[model samples]
Target: MWYLRRFLLRQPRSHALCPTSPSSSHAPSSSLPSSPLQCRTLSSTGGAGFYNFPPSAHYDLIVIGSGPAAQKCAIDSVKRGRRVAMIDKNSQMGGVCVHTGTIPSKTFREAVLHLTGYRHQGFYGKSTFTSSRRSSMNEILQRVQKVEDVEAEVTRHQMRRNGVHLVTGTARFLENGANDAHVKLAVLLTDPEQERKGIYKHREASLPKTLLTAEKVMIACGTRPVRQEETVFDGKRVFDSDQLLWGGIDRVPRSFIVVGAGVIGIEYASMINVLPGTNVTIIDPRPNLLGFADREVVDALMYSMRHYGARFVLGEKVGYPALASTSMEQGRRASCHMWGDFEAIPEHSMAAEQGGEVKSVLQQGGFLGRDTERLFPYGIYTIPEISMIGKTEEQLTAEKVPYEVGIANYKELAKGQMLGGMDGFLKLIFSTEDFRILGVHAIGEGATEIVHIGQVVMAAGGSVHYFVDAVFNFPTLAEAYNVAAHNGLKNMGINV
Candidate 1:
């Protein structure tokens, strides 16, 4: 990683990938220079491996998928003056993060919080809002769309201004052309949805596929909620996280069963459970949730969520939807459209023999999957968000690393009290001997933002004393670090 960063810095922008366009597909370019390979291996060099697409169509770096990972890589490459082209199946750019997943879910949470007076309940009560007994699904969706629109536009503009050729279509790897020196891939330029609906912009829509080769291709197509092949997606009763936004959810369901206890599942459970008339029961195969966070923090979050009427059925594995019902149609007829992990909700006390088709849906994805080895942060937006980094106490203990824990509750901080975030808290774990920061965990407002303070210090080899001596503005959540430092040092028998 360090070597790659240094190399990128040394490479001149003139040697960047040449952004391709509609015309480039029709007539490949012949402008590639045969400069010294330097360190440009098949993986790093615009893809001198097996793909055998037209040389003129070759880009310096081809980033597939417009999600965060792809976006960052593309931007970095283009800033170096590389010809970069980014492609996605969605008509609107930004992939799932902006279009259907993160942006929509978080915005939905905010909308639910504001519309139902969830945050304002401390002072004005739930009745502080209008006389509506239940929140309309349309109202929640409006906020999500508005946010997604702005974010997607920003992403597209960011790529365009940086000279990234934006291709709206689906991308697929062709052959492992071992004999070829370039990496070749295929793209369907027509919108996927339009093709599905048999709606064509013109007679040429039916044949929108383009085969282009690149020096290097980055597969950033973020994973979607993987519903089983047999599972039916009526869009109303059954849906994935992406579909959950479009017609993912109709209204705040009276009750929904979330199959996975990963970040997304818990987040959706937390947000929807707070609605006027909604209930959520989250099921996970793991006994403990958020295995990466501090035990105390996860415990607190679970307790709060339970108090809010969200049920957690941990250590329970979901049966296959096929085994639960004789046929897919029968499963859908149960009122709850079956998909993903839920073979049956028998574990949930709220489950009944019949509901025809459950108004609720299943959460079909997680940060970690046994099938893949990708690592990413898990941020669950449950009112007060939860974020963590580095090793947890459990992981360290299992590995026999000595560690200590220090906690600062939001209730004990003036800032938390000021903003009615008494429910929030920060947990800092540092080595016992030197008090060097190990991991920082927080569950409360701006927790996602707070973890970075500890991360920066830890990366710099700073210890607990760094936080204690450092002065933060009074009445700010960042000051929680000060509190954590005081508690940690005090435990170590040091006087303030």
Candidate 2:
């Protein structure tokens, strides 16, 4: 292990590199100090193949991260007989995925699944179980820690095994005055003394200024939880997705307004739903979750979520419009905000959902920043990847329409896991308060085709009982129809 010690001192002058704090510190740059300042360095004894080099070290390649991507890149270069070094400000070897994102989120899912017994919950009629065992935040997090520690250790072992040196400090690029092609910009590492003491500390009292120049630089720095300017993430009551799964959180909230319906949003909402005494309300402007997947898959997911006591506010904003009206002009038919210059034909009427900036009427739709609805200034998509057309449960609920959903999971299907895809579900929403099929929504490996099953049934004016009565091909996600029909019936107080 390379003990990256803290640089105890810096030359008393303005420096170029941005400051590196344990929190919220990005890279900064400044010219090297004219004179050296007192610093400290220390390393644990018995470090295999231990070596120390001043900050003036140069390498063939400098990777500015220690995540899976960085680790692989560094190791590959080393195998090709290239000298490579990796840098990371977070004292841990693994990046955000292992520490916060995928690893912890999946781990949290397992804990919730086991504690809630969600798969078989449908066998019981009610959303809540009086006999259900409740798990504490401490207990759940303790389980997550064991998994995280093992993953981190594996990552550290990989780096050491491959001889990829790790520099634990904030790294930023130095300005290249000459703009030389052979020698790229130098990288400056600003490590605080207190920071070094916490992690692997160096043995020397003074840490040499590290200014590394490399032939090439690769920025493998992964992502962090986005803390938008609109919301105040206090981390106690409010948290970004990353902070919620991290161990720093003290308690699981009794109630929460989880924003977004994307993968993270849906996964978290589902996980939280299984927790005892917890109510989860998911909000998103989209009409449904995993809208592009098969309607059946999404429907199945929604059924599971609702059965677990979760609520969704879909295609609706909580508060405020995107841009308010300054003055209502009689010349235009609708009250709208005009961003581009258009000849306003006097009294021309225009409805919303056309993506036009003008608000023709005082309709109940608008952006509420972070606390309200999502306001997208611009978002672009071009290929024909996947598409769907359906109404959400929120819409049905608001309209006082009677409907039931048949649900299925991709994992339940053998060959259709890809079609039922990972983290995907198939749902059939029908007017089946003993009425016709309403719509099918799905998101899964088999979403595209699975949805067609419900669509065909809906088109034929068949009720969900069709699924209950029919025998589907085995080892197929289509069989989810059987399970979902059973679940829908259970929810409606029907024994069959």
Candidate 3:
């Protein structure tokens, strides 16, 4: 991991992939040029190699993902005059970040909010139909498509203008050789029909299409949803994030019982709750929503969501819907309820208790208070989003690292207030002795976007005093740095 980090952060001194002069009309081909691209490759087995690939020939750098990080790295390499190749199995580029994960989800949230009258509920009551309401699923999807199209075009144009080759395929690394030896890659060209038949069919038709011998390769395949056999989604009733987007918007569940209160789940619940006549219930084992976020921001979000009639069933396990015994025609209403019975599984208890013996007396008749488990058959959402680049509170406690916590409410910032965002807050964890910022946590609107400020400070090995002494622009959300730094200093008994 350390080697990988070093390789990623290290700057190359020469251009290994491109040799064409910036003023030259044609790009330098795969031939030894005046300068070569600098690349460092690291293997899991402590094997490392530094190579300067000649400008002439095939790809010098091959990035195996089309997500934001992958795109950024590829574009940067291209700009440096390297022959870069980016590959993905999906029919479209941009990976999940654009196709399903971030852009599509956010766009859907915006559409839902607009359609549900949340944007102007104070003035329009429940009767008014916002632009999202009149828009069909196709319309909303088109917006996502348009954005992705623009992004894909931009990436393609940049790559082409910079002399990067974009390829579509499934790539797998073969056996490694001696030091400085070239690595083998198996690229499987995907067919639309074979992809429909699934991996088995595709595997049967797989051919050794191309052997890309590159000086460096980046594995940024991203991640996929984890599904258990017991809780497998069946398209109509249960759905994952990817399926939810392609399945259409007309099927929005009347009442959703989200099973997780993580960022993705809560974000979806918040967006769905904004829709008129739609009820959203979030379930999680954590006592507080957004447990990883700053306490103040979590509190504010909880407060805001409560006012919107969003229900939270914390510390609970969600289960499948229970079937009614009575026939539909037998003067009985169709029952649609899912129950999450709180079972004290011994294994889970032991695991939670760190392998310690659990002292529990099981009540007779399948335990008492079982009725507390009620049915709430509903669509569920769950996604795990977390960022940790520095010391956490637990680490500080275990290591006896003295630290002070400083918090700044985004609502207090001029830009935040201008955006009508009152829920987000920034917390800076700083060392009490040196006043260096240890960690920062922010959540609400643009939490991920703003956390980079903290990352920059931490990466630079700077201290909280840097922010406190620095002058931030007026009315900027970044002013939270000043607010938090000052608070940290006060906590440290410093005059500043």
Poorest 10 consecutive residues by lDDT, candidate 2: 1-10
Stretches of candidate 3 exceeding 4 Å from the true structure = 1-63, 69-85, 110-139, 171-188, 192-219, 285-292, 321-395, 410-417, 446-450, 459-470, 488-496
> Can you give the lDDT of residue 30 in candidate 2?
40
- Find the 10 residues in a row with the least total lDDT in model 1: 1-10
lDDT tens digits, residue span 271-354, model 3? 666555566676676677654344554566666777777787888754533411100000001101000001121101112121
lDDT of 1 by residue, 30-79 (tens): 55433211121233243232122223355777776676656666776665
Best by TM-score: 1
Q: What is the full ranking by TM-score, best candidate first?
A: 1, 3, 2
How high is the CA lDDT of each candidate model? 0.61, 0.51, 0.52
In Å, residue 193's CA in model 3 sits off its true spot by: 7.4
lDDT of 1 at 187: 61
Candidate 1, residue 80: how far the Cα is off, in Å: 2.9
lDDT comparison, 1 vs 2, better candidate: 1
- Candidate 2 runs further than 4 Å off: 1-53, 119-133, 182-208, 319-496
Identify the superior model by TM-score, candidate 1 or candidate 3. 1
lDDT of 2 by residue, 1-496 (tens): 0000011111110111233232112121344332222233445552322233343555666766555555656776676666777776655666655765457766777676655554344355235553655667777777788898898888788877887666655554544545534333333333444444533243222333356566666554544433334444555555556556555456666776665555555666667776777777776667866553444445656775686687888886534123121100011111111211021221111111221222211111334233212121110010001223355565677799988766666566665443323355556666755656666655544344565676567656688888899998887777888887887788778878
